[model samples]
Target: MLSMVRRPNPVQWLRYAAGGRLPDHLREWVLRDVTTRTWFLRGAARSSLLVLPLSSVWLLLPGPLGLRLSLCLMALLVGYFYSLAYLEESCEHKLVKHGYRYGSGRATRNAAKDALEAEAHARYVARYRN
Candidate 1:
């Protein structure tokens, strides 16, 4: 299954991050990328890549070292909060940009979540209700 999934190399990934679309061959990977269990983490990491450099500039301003560090940390936290708040929409947008229909990514993610819940419920029934 892993071999069937062709991942984008670093350069391609950077381009994709910059709003470029991947080739048709990588569409499946794009769907998996936006729908996987770690999608939130991936989104947060991408958000940090944008936020970190801008926040780091605060260090160059003449200020107390602790103050500069605190400001940077604050910026990071605020950016992360907004990123999470918009994560689902952002992912759906990416899917659309990659040639997927709108809401497919959300549907896929929800399906996987529902399957997990169903499996867990079955286990609970077997252990406690039976």
Candidate 2:
């Protein structure tokens, strides 16, 4: 039935964050971005990582207004990246369940082969007199 563990509540969420757990939504949301191969989500996650450090530094700059804005941005980015990481991990786990691995090989090869063989067999039979 594809049951997933429930997401943490607000208090637990805060506690998890405080205890150094990234604020990932967990479960299918993680897999949704990764296994589903959503380009937007993947790209956002990659770009977010690239930007995190720069944003951190920017928050430390001289201007108070800029610092406040940057801090807010940093928090936002952290949440985004946390979700991304969780999604990526979830997707990876899901893929592994189906015998897929990133950079291991083309995961769908067996399925493809089966499909092609079926098609070829049908075509061959269609062309025979019998």
Candidate 3:
């Protein structure tokens, strides 16, 4: 639940604060944990930062309706997925900064560690291994 939000670095805290205003109680909770910031990117604030160029497409594609449509669709998808990727990536820095991860990447380090440890187990039966 809370893992959905990774604490941000001290320097990046400004980015979170700049996005929008939070209620006093909520703000207190966030400030309570300097380890990570709420990744709750507000509606337009975060999405506005998306790198889509639909305006350029309209300007450049003066003809070919199908091509333009396809390009527009592609741009929408690219921007959508790119923004999601950015959000996940933005949270990833917490793994190194705090020795813990949050958001979608949370437990990834633990999972990897578990996998590595499993590989070293010496009590498993041959049939179980297979």
- Score every model by TM-score: 0.88, 0.27, 0.34
* Candidate 3 CA-lDDT value: 0.49
Of 1 and 3, which scores higher on TM-score? 1
Superposed by TM-score, candidate 2 places the C-alpha of residue 17 at a distance from the truth, in angstroms, of: 11
lDDT for every model? Answer: 0.87, 0.51, 0.49
Q: What is the per-residue lDDT of model 3 for residues 80-121, given as tens digits with 9 covering 90 to 100?
A: 676666655544442334344344244543565577678666
Better of 1 and 3 by lDDT: 1
Per-residue lDDT over 1-130 for candidate 1, one digit per residue giving the tens place of the 0 to 100 score: 8578999999888777656788888999889888999998887777777778888998999989999999999988887788789989988998998888999998999999999999999999999998
Every model: Cα RMSD to truth = 1.6, 9.6, 9.4
Q: List the residue pairs that clash in candidate 3.
A: 7-36, 7-37, 8-36, 8-37
**Candidate 2 Cα errors over 4 Å, as ranges:** 1-29, 46-50, 63-130
Ranking by lDDT: 1, 2, 3
Assess candidate 2 and give its TM-score to the true structure.
0.27
